[model samples]
Target: MSPVCLIARDEWRALLRNRAGLLASGLLVLLVLVASFTSLERRAAIEADRERYQASVDEQFDQQPDRHPHRMVHYGQFVFRPIAPLAFFDTGVDSYTGNTIFLEGHRQNSANFAEARQSSLLMRFGQLTPAFVLQTLAPLLLIFLGFASISRERERGTLRLMAAQGVAARQVMLGKLLAHGVIALIIGLPAFLVLSGFAATGAAGWATVLPMIAGYAAWLLLWAVLSVVVSGLFHRSRDALAILIGVWMVGVILLPRVLPVMAEQRTQLDTNIETEIALHRKLADIGDSHDPEDPYFNDFREQVLDEYGVESIEDLPVQYAGLVSIEGERLTTGIYADSAARSSARENAQNALVHDFSIISPLIAIRQLSMTLAGSDLASHYDFLQQTEAFRYNFVQRLNRMQAELIPGIGGEDPRISAEYWQEIPRFHYQAPSPFSRPSDLIWPAAVLLGWLVALSALAAWASNRLERNLR
Candidate 1:
């Protein structure tokens, strides 16, 4: 075998001989498996519960008794965002972003009943999913296993012995890299297996699963290479361990926590109360239909009259009040859409600001990749909200059209539309945003991860050269 291969073999043997390192690795693998099973069960339960709730709400909407179309508008409908199959691996922002929305006419409601609000305090720490394990805990494990990869050799003088035996510095570095890189792959094997199983079962598409696996693989390998490279930089194993731990703390723990706060402060988002108040103000600015002399409504009435080629509201073939309701819905919906877009923009800006720091903390990059691939990110939630709004507008408009066209010649204060019309309103069928719908969302983070790996590999080469000089 080649010298590099022999050195790698010896390194693996050394790791095997270290009982504590072996035990730690064993426990992490076990933890990953447990996390996988637990996450799968939890996801299934959530999916079932949401499905049941959606069915119940749909049935109730269909079962409403004969009533005025306007009355039905206020009754509203509930739409629950379906959980994505890969959400089992990384819950992401789903726990915080509520899945269900109450959609009604002339108004847009915020999603309510988030898991975070209902769960215990322990949830604040984070979920125990495969992504969490691989992203956060896995790096720490790599540090523990390889922090002394070269520093220990220096401390014990084996590095010099190897040098005297004619082993090249590049060979030694390559051997360490090979050993730890393989170990990194081994560490991620359980998660990869679970992902493959999900794909085999047709739970997630291969397109998404493959990229997710690649991003994480790079993430683990980056840490392993970083550990080996840093280890070579120090003369003492303790110093190398300390440095690696600090890097892990900053990149994995500290920055992930701090950057979000910084991002939030950097770009302030409007609060719910503030948004509602603004919406109400905008609605009020558009004069109420109830006011007989309101100019906006007067002009709207004239438009309806001209459209129907009638002289006044009373002569129109359809209920004039229904026409007003339709117009009101259109106006309000337009305003609400504008508000939603602004809010989405602000959120995207905040997230972009945070993502910009991914260069400093590759954890951000992997996290972005994981959540986007799983379809549990903020963008996915926003897509759900947008689709629900569209459904709401269509459902409400159908009822408005029903009241205008079917109500008997208009004069009754409480005109009723046939109950059969309720069935005509469509149910909300959410088309989950394609995981690859926006390439930039995946590409940037992925590039960051791959870039980190490449940069670390370059650092390893430089460190190898330094090690050789020290030995000479």
Candidate 2:
């Protein structure tokens, strides 16, 4: 056997004999398996509930008796975000960002009833999903198992003895990396298999899932190399362990929390109340329908008359009031959409800052990559909102069109429309955001992760060379 392979085999045997290593690995495996099954079940339950609610809402809308078309517009509709197939693995921002949105004419309702808002403070710390396990805890586990790999040999004088036996420095370091790399792969295999099974059965996209698996594999391998190199750098096992723990604490635990706060502070965003007040002011400036002297409405009235070849709005073919309602809705919808666009831009700008700093914490980069692939990120949620908004516009306008075309011609006291027309109006259909479109979103983050690995490999080489000379 090659000397490097021989040393690697020996290291693997040592790990098997180490009780702490064996026990930790076992527990983590169990945790991941449990997480996998339970996450899927939870995901399924949420999906079923959303589907049920949507069906019920649609039914209620369809069953409405003869009523004024404007009244039906006020009846509104509900839209629920569809969970991506791989959401069980990542969950991402789903828990905090409400999955359901109330969509109505003249108003953009907030998404409400999020899980985190209902849960106790303990839930704020973290979730127990597979992504959480791998992102937050698995690196710590690797640190515990491999932190002492080279340092222990040095502390016990075995490293000097190996050099005296004519063992090469590069071979010794390669053996440590190989041993820990195998362990990292072993540690990640169960979760990968679970995800792969999801992909194979068509629960998730194969292209996205394959890349997800590769990202995680690279993440684990990066940690393993760091652990082995840190061990090589330190002469004392305890010293190496301390440094590794510190790195884990800062990189995995501290920075993720801190950086977002920093980003938010840097990019100021308006509160919901402030945004609503601003919207109201903008609408007020656009002219009130009730005020006959309002210049904006006067101009709109002229346009309507000219369009229908009539001298007065009252003499037009359609009900002037219903025509006015349609024009009013168009103006309001435009202003509301503008506010929404600005709000979305601000929120995304804040997130952009955080993503830019992903290099400082590779964990954040992996998280962005993970969430993007899973289709459970903020971007996906935003896409849901956009789709829902567009649907709401079309739906309300259809009822307004009904009022303008059908109700004016009937000339009844109630000014009602046939209930059958309700069924003709479209229901909300959420178009799942395509992961394929945002390959650029993953590129920078993945590059940051790869950069970490390459930089650490060079440091590992330098440490190995220095260790070789010191022993000689």
Candidate 3:
């Protein structure tokens, strides 16, 4: 048999005989299976709840009695963002972002009822999902299984004996790497299968599912290589294990928490209260629709008369007050949207700063990537808000038009449009972007994982060369 093959076979036998290794590997397999089942079930529950809420909201919107258009505007509909199919694999920032938003005219509401706000602080410990298992815990398990691979051989003086028998250092290192890499693959396989099954059954797109699997695979292989390299460099098995564990703690636990705090501190986003106050101030400057003699309304009144060629608003073919209300709403809605965009941009900047730290910690990178792919990240939340805002604008304008065209002909002191106008208004339909459209967000994380793999591979090579010299 080839020298590398012989070494690999021997190493595999050694791993099997080590009770600790067998027990750790078995436990990891069990954890993966459990994580897959629980995450899938949790994801299904969330999706069902959102769907049911959306149906309830839609039904309520359809059942409103005849009232002033502005009354319906204040009574405003609620829209719930749906969970993405791959969210089962990684809950991501879903817990942080609000799932429900209230839509109304002349007001931009912040998404309310985020899970983070509702949950106890323990939620920050981390959510249990297949992505979480693979990104954070799986690496630690690989380190525990492989951190003693080469170090133990050296401590027992068997490495020197192998060199005396003419077995090359490269051969031993390669063999150890092969064995640990296979074990890492085994630990990650069930989650991959579950994700693939989701994709096959049309729960998620292949675009997201494939990249997610590849990203996770790269992440696990990165830890496997690092573990093997550390084990090769250390003279004692205990030293290797300690160093690897410290590395895992800092990379996986410490940075994900610390960076977000730093990002929030550095960016200093405006509170929702501040945002609402600023919006109110802006609307006040835009002139009230109810005030007949307001300058802005006076100018708008003239423009409508000029367009319709009438001497007085009451003589015009359409209801001048409703047209003014529509124009006023348009102005207020535009200002609100601009304010929302500014706030969203600020939040995104904060998130980007956190993502920059992902370069230092692959766990953050993978977490962001997984969230982005699952459509549960901040970006997805923002997308839902923007779409809902657009829907609110369209729905309100349709009602305003009904008031303008239909209320005048009905001719009452308080002319109300028929309830039939509400039925003509389109319901909100959220169009989530495909994973490919948002691939750039994942690129940095993917690059971080690739960088870790390359750096560790080089370190492994350097360690192998040193081992060869030490043996000589």
Every model's TM-score? 0.98, 0.98, 0.96
User: What global local distance difference test value does model 1 have?
Assistant: 0.90
Q: How far is candidate 2 from the true structure (C-alpha RMSD, Å)?
A: 1.3
Residue 255 alpha-carbon offset, candidate 1, angstroms: 0.9
Q: List the residue pairs that clash in candidate 1.
A: none
| Model 2 worst lDDT run, 10 consecutive residues | 287-296
Write model 1 residue lDDT over 225-274, tens digit each, in one string: 99999999899999999999999999999998998899889889999899
Worst 10 residues of 3 by lDDT: 412-421
Q: How accurate is candidate 3 locally (lDDT)?
A: 0.83
Model 2 spans > 4 angstroms off: 289-295
TM-score of 2: 0.98
Full-model lDDT for every candidate = 0.90, 0.88, 0.83
lDDT of 2 by residue, 1-472 (tens): 9889988998999899999899999999889999999999999999999999999999998999988888987888887887999889998998898888887777777778888998889987788999999988899999988998998888888888888898988899999999999999999999999999998898787898999999999899989999999999988889999999999999998889998899889888899789989999998888864344467888888888888999976688887767767777888889988888888898889888888878878998999999999998998888888888888888888888888888877886877888999998888888787876887788988898999999999998999899888887
- Quote model 3's TM-score: 0.96
